[model samples]
Target: MTSIITHNDQELLKLIGERQNHQAFEVLYQRHFDAVFRYVFKVMQDRETAEDVVQNIFISLWKKPPSLNHPTLLPYLFGAARNQIAKEIRKNKWNKEQLDFIENTKGICSTDEYLEERDTRKLLESGIQKLPQKCRNVFKLSRFSYLSNKQISEKLGISVFTVENHIKKALYLLRQSIEFIVICLVSWY
Candidate 1:
């Protein structure tokens, strides 16, 4: 008897979780899909990967709606998107252009430099993984996704100040982790 749109996120989530209500799920999906898609697209920079990631997020929600302590679901959805993106990256499934660029660069750099660069990249990624969860998410959205502070704030449901702080913390930890590589590179040149 009531319009689904009138329900808040928690109420709709309850309907989906308790009753397996398709209408509630659809309403929730419609409410957040565009924002989630745009966020994933920006991070993935590939339309197909972005679509798949967004679809999976919604599918997972429908299959098993999460119990949320937060007032809104945007943060959870975004976290799921980040996890999917990380999985894709870890799979080493680079697009053709990325692979081509890597292949093209092999001829330009010395083997030693190339290897060192690769190692440095690995160290940075390791450092990112070691970061606090919230900090890592903010850093990836800011650096890898190339999103503005305002954009990240809106997506993560955090203030811009919080975004900046996380970015700062991530950078500091990453710099510490890779300081030796930077010193070596500088000394070589």
Candidate 2:
């Protein structure tokens, strides 16, 4: 068997798409699996779902390999992965909203308890806002944007170590502030 490793992506893609060479498809899968998996896992945040998505992406590639040039292949794969992730998120959100609506209609909680929960959530939000600028940005990217530490680093142009430190500091500050709020509330009670 000719080693597909030495072949450029263009050659490998042509072999798979035009010639229907299954081995060539295997080589493409091996080459791009880790990168595609990481990107998917960063967005999905679940190992099982991410793995399934990656497999589906590869299967799609095999079934209908685009006329992707070598230089554009990785970006194309990433774009597809992002699109899949967006669709999954939308589906999950819709399901959650339906459940929330059903539960709310059932009158699960009293008005007072709902008010307390809202106050607690507001306090947490304030605590997050009190974080130092860089720390807050990193924390928001990690939590709200759902970005991995490496992705945050790349987007923010910082080292991964710095991103980790910022997240840790943000978390610590928020925890301390929340604890203080709880203590004050308990003392009042």
Using TM-score as the measure, which candidate wins?
A: 1
lDDT of 2: 0.76
lDDT of 1 at 173: 88
lDDT for each residue of candidate 2 in 1-189, tens digit (9 for 90 to 100): 567777766787788788888988888888778767866675566878888888988888888888864433666676677666666767776345434433343332344544575588689789988999999999999986668999999999999999999999998899999999889989999
TM-score of each: 0.49, 0.48
Expressed as tens digits, the lDDT of each residue in 108-147 for candidate 1 is: 3334544565577678888899999999999999886768
Clashes of each: 0, 0
Let me know the TM-score candidate 2 reaches against the reference structure.
Answer: 0.48
Clashing pairs in 1: none
